[model samples]
Target chain A: MNLIGLGLVGFSALLLLLFSIAKRKSPVKLRAIPALTRLYRAFGLSVEDGTRLFIALGRESLITPNAGAPLSGLGMLRHLTERTSLSDRPPIAAAGEASLALLAQDTLEAGYQAAGAGEYYQPTTGRLTGMTPFSFAAGAMPILRDESVSASVLIGHFGVEAALLADAAERENAFLVGASDDLSSQAALYASAPEALIGEELFATSAYLGATQSHTASLTVQDILRWLIILALLAGAALKLLGMI
Target chain B: MRAIAVVLAVATGLLVLIGYFIPTLAPIQSMILNWAIILSGAAALVGVFNLIWVHWGKISRREKGSLYSAILLICLIATLIFGMLLGPDDSNMRLLVNSIIVPVEATLMALLAVTLVYASIRLLRRRANLMSVVFLATALLLLIASATLPFGEIGPLNNFVRPWFQHAWALGGARGILIGVALGTLMTGLRVLFGADRPYGGK
Candidate 1:
């Protein structure tokens, strides 16, 4: 097998092994991510204020390579739905793509079923705002303005258009926590969002927020792999300096 | 049942994942990817219908700002009919896309640049941290270095500093983020492949 393929299989095997082990063990202590902590606090604030919470699942398509962000975002959605399912106004999810929107709906329904509040679930709570980036931003702007949303969590694959949504949420005085896998979007979020998740933190949402064993194990694996990569890079640089290669 | 979905997901995922390495399995991967794309496209159509249902409900109930809903419906139907009749590549459809959609999107993008500037300026006011100061400084320096100087270009600031910052510092950070994202993507896909995470419907 080629290096790329070998790497993929090796990593998958490692992740699966880690996941199985994690499932059998007690919860591990994870480093606190301020943004995730803020998000959880926002959920409580939404409940206390009796205001709606809005989540922007972004416009990434599930069939494409860019599905990672939305998938990670859904993990957060699943966790949020469990807490907010019984609220008078449950969290509303707005997605850029249709499949993500449908999945978000299913996730909400599943959350309600798990909570034994399936009758309270409404398909309308999960909305497919638009198919395109700017259109999605435009579609979501009205909801942010009119829905009395107290907290807005935007996590997914966002482009430069994320600024528009962040600005809208700011205008509405909503508590905002934004994260994205896109660098430019992350930079914009750093500036726009009061709390922003940087780099690998987006992937750790399920671990920190949901406390899922699989997600936590995957995160631990990611950390170990990241350290290994850093060591490799450093060694390569050192070898080059010594004219070894 | 959920078990069937998990089995299908694992099977298809292995085929596609293995296909990435083995040359002979490429065709199978391509076919599966194509099927997925088609299914996603069909899902998008369902989303459009969902959008229509939502707006229709708003209009029917005479909800607040239903005028906007009515306008959206009219525009959607008009564009849909126009595209269907003349085809997507036709001059009329292109005109509609170029003249209306592009300009609105461009305006929003332009607005984003201004918003970024505003946010950068206000960063310190919101949180007076070292990162905020560094962010503001870098943004201002980048803006100034990239701009025309009217008289002439500054030497160190325009040449060495900006280039080093852009190519070395900025590029390094971007690469780091890319690596992190790549790792995250692999783990997420692996989760689905192993049936530990079922995003299709299961818990």
Candidate 2:
């Protein structure tokens, strides 16, 4: 890794720790529904009873220093599953990566146990949808059309092919909420014009939705470090212009 | 277990981060990178197994498009056997994959370019007012600029076509967008850190 890459990762880790601490102390509430959330809810309203909440997670680039998006997205799935347990409804999670699918199973099981709905938890229910971006989209899109999907949330590392799924959700009048920090993926989901959280925002989703200490700690470290970096860059530029080195 | 995972995740993260800044840490960085690749590769194998199991069920049940499943199974087994037994240096299996898989994947991706153009055309056809017209014009110009053109001097047109569209306008806008994205990412991170949002399990 180069300096820029190191700075990016260290800064991200520092922020993760900060956010985690912050989450431990104070949990933020998103009182107003984000536009995508609202759109998804509206889509859900038209669906039939017993329709499941479908979530597709893509782990396209986990090797990259920033694994925040998929990790946080997993956290969100945990939150969602807990919420789902309170109701008579069941949700289906379609994971793009097999490892994530296994994690999702555990997370969902944990959520159910926490909510005292452990009886309803099934390993087969949580599925590994597909591997490639196109294959996953192709597989998940059909669920939206043929099966009654009340609400759909795609949170993780996805590619432009997400557009197909988003479009399918829209056509079915199913609620669709998407969050991806990757720039290329965001561009593909234009019709939904998803209210995406860029880069570190993906890391913050768990804290944003459910206040985790790890997240808070990271967030805090990031803020302080970023400001320092900005200041240093400005000073350096000024020094260079003045030939003071 | 949770504590261990957190500690390990953070430790690996820090090591990788430091590896970027210090030349001496390059080996550590390389090791981390290797681990990441290994982990993902392991995950891919899991995915392949899942794919095979799912498709095998479809085949047994005589599900629609089971022919595709058959093709997939045949290819998967054939490729695995050839590559594993004959070795990449000796087998023609690698060539088959390169010729077939690469071209098909590339062609599928090329379809996206067509989709974008089609979308633009659809939007233009349903123009209701001023905003639509501007969008249509922007789309058209962007398409024209992105299309392959020779570097040979077509006078002022070439200058305007490449620089204004590609370098000055697009590049500047892209750079600005990236910065904005970075800032937005930073804010979201801050929000999480400050406990303004709670998406995690333990409040």
Candidate 3:
């Protein structure tokens, strides 16, 4: 047994429980994240104006270390789908991995069902743009033109190849919000994307997009853990400096 | 149905998690992984079909990109047929991949380098915030320092500035970001394990 791994998991689970209880009494508030606020605003406008929206869920398959970013994108997609289900032209999802594409379809359907608009569900909305990273970006670039997408969120496991998609969105004059797990992609996106979520901000999509109280609780737990980890790192550095090891 | 899905998920997660801890469950873990690999391969086929279907619609409806779709379909069909007959390890299959996919992807990567430089300048123009200024300056400094002049490496830039920025500041910031990302991933996974968050069809 990896005792340290088990310990971390247990600690996190406990924090989640504590936060969940606390969440019931009062609302969980997060600091203003302009990226998300802008995205939500775009969603409202997209629906109201009957323009299309695109979400490029990047190339990483679900069963990898890079899966978390893509999964976060999926969570956001589910919520966004529900919100946009009533629109004349709902959001389109483009993914690189085949399985992720399958999951995106399922998520979209679930979202439509949740919105009580299952009849409006379109399977083509969830598309496997390409199987490879660069290919995926190339395939997804057309959504801006073909669908006349006015807003896009490039939230996924992307590499430097993400810049191409961002450039395409820019050309269309679409509101572009991007976040990725990989550092190179993040940097590239930061340069091109007007509203870029840096670092772990991408993972906060579910909570920011109003998924559930549980998501808020999870976010709170994550916030606490971040502080705890920071303290531990600083303490470790101090101890090492003192040669106390 | 949702309940069944949740039960299946929890059981699979527990089995995999516990199997990692106890050596006795290694065989079970290996078997489960094999199942996952098979499912992944099947899903890839589904993805290909989905691509074909979408493109087919484009062609049938005489959409704007119908000609591109036709070309893509033709190429895809030819490649698949050749790949099946020659097999993946065959010289012809290698030739096919090396001839087409490699050069295109490599060209895109080369294009990326130029785009990144342009993007940095564009960043400053688009957003003149503190972060943007810092980002552009650092990128410019790194570019200059990393390059070899007619004489040699820039003394302070290469020996002190670049090294300090790369080794200390960048490394520290990257590690901090990584820690946060890891924590988020762990929490998200745990949320699913606890059945508090169902990202599957159940949600």
Candidate 4:
């Protein structure tokens, strides 16, 4: 048995439970992420202006190691859908994978239902853009162009093909906010996107989107675990420097 | 229904997770995974139908871009028919894929190279800060260093600067980001297993 792995899981679950309880007493004050804040504002502006917001959930399978980013994208979709439910043009979620498209559809439905705007929901609001990475980017370009999209969010798995979507958004003069798990995509977006969240910041979508205290609890557990990992790495490096085993 | 779904998800997740430490439960995990794969395949079909339905609405309603929708639907039907008739391994199928999909993707890649160059220039025009200049210079150096000139390769850059910047600096930052992403993924996964956050339509 991998005892260390089991230990880490147990520790994380314990921290999660503890924080979930603590959250009811007082709200957790999270460090602000400016890019995410701007993304929220842009979506709000799209609603106010009677323009659509397009969320491009990249073509990553739910079963893959890269599923986290796209799942996070879905979480954000739910929140955004609720926020934009009463708008003339509801937000559109375009995903690359078939299963993800289905989930996106479900999330949108749930969001609208929660907001008491279920009658305004349309299945077409959640789209399956394409099956492949480049094709997905190609398929999504038209939606960004033709849908009266005032703003777009690319918060999924993308590689160099992100440049194409960015270019499309650029041409359309839409506000672009992108975040991805892949470094290549992140770097490209850093150059093109006005607001781009790098690395693990992609996972902060739900916490920043007015999600439940459970989301905040998870963020706290993640922060604590991050510090622990950093300390372990530092200790290991120091031991190596001292010629210790 | 929500409670049942959450219980099933948590139970299945626990079983699969426990299967890791208990060899006896491995088969149960495998069986559940097989079911998941089948569900995903079925979901893909639903997705294709959704695509067709959306485009059909656009075409029927004569939306502004309905022409594109018609073309897409025609192409999609043709591809599906050809693939179904001859199967994926047939030479004609290979020809169809190679002739259409491959070239389209390659063209996209070519466009991406141009787009990156354009974006780099625009980055300079927009940001123009100290970090932006350094970013632009570093990207240029790396691109030039990796290329072969008329005379020969840039030996000093390929040998020294490129390696140092990539391995010493970029790699460190990348590793740090990766560790953070890993932690975040773990937390997200745990949230689902714990039913803290449900992306499957649960409120």
| Candidate whose lDDT is highest | 4
Number of clashing residue pairs, candidate 3: 0
Whose DockQ is greatest here?
Answer: 4
DockQ of each: 0.70, 0.23, 0.71, 0.76
Which of 1 and 3 is the better model by DockQ? Answer: 3
Give Cα-based local distance difference scores for all models.
Answer: 0.86, 0.63, 0.87, 0.88
Model 2, range A190-234, lDDT digits (tens) per residue? 334233444444555555555555544544655566577678879
Candidate 1 residue spans exceeding 4 A from truth = none
Candidate 4 residue-wise lDDT at A162 = 86
Candidate 2's C-alpha runs over 4 A off are A1-33, A39-48, A59-61, A85-90, A95-101, A124-133, A143-146, A191-204, A211-245, B4-36, B56-75, B82-91, B118-137, B146-158, B176-203
lDDT of 3 by residue, A1-245 (tens): 47777777778888888878888889678888988998999989999999988998999987776778888888899889989999999889999999899989998998999999999998988999998888898789887777779999999899999998888888899999999989988889999888899888988998888756678888888888888887998899999999997
Better of 2 and 4 by TM-score: 4
The digit string of per-residue lDDT tens for model 4 on A89-184 reads 889999999999999999999999999988988999999989998889988999988889998899988888987898899899999889999989
Task: Answer with 2 or 3, whichever has the higher lDDT.
Answer: 3
Model 1 error, position A81 (Å): 0.8
- Superposition TM-score, candidate 1 onto the true structure: 0.96
Candidate 3 chain A, poorest ten consecutive residues by summed lDDT = A1-10
How would you encode candidate 3's per-residue C-alpha lDDT over B51-163 as one tens digit per residue?
Answer: 99999998999988789889989999999999889899999899989999999999988887887777777887888899999888898899899998899988999999999
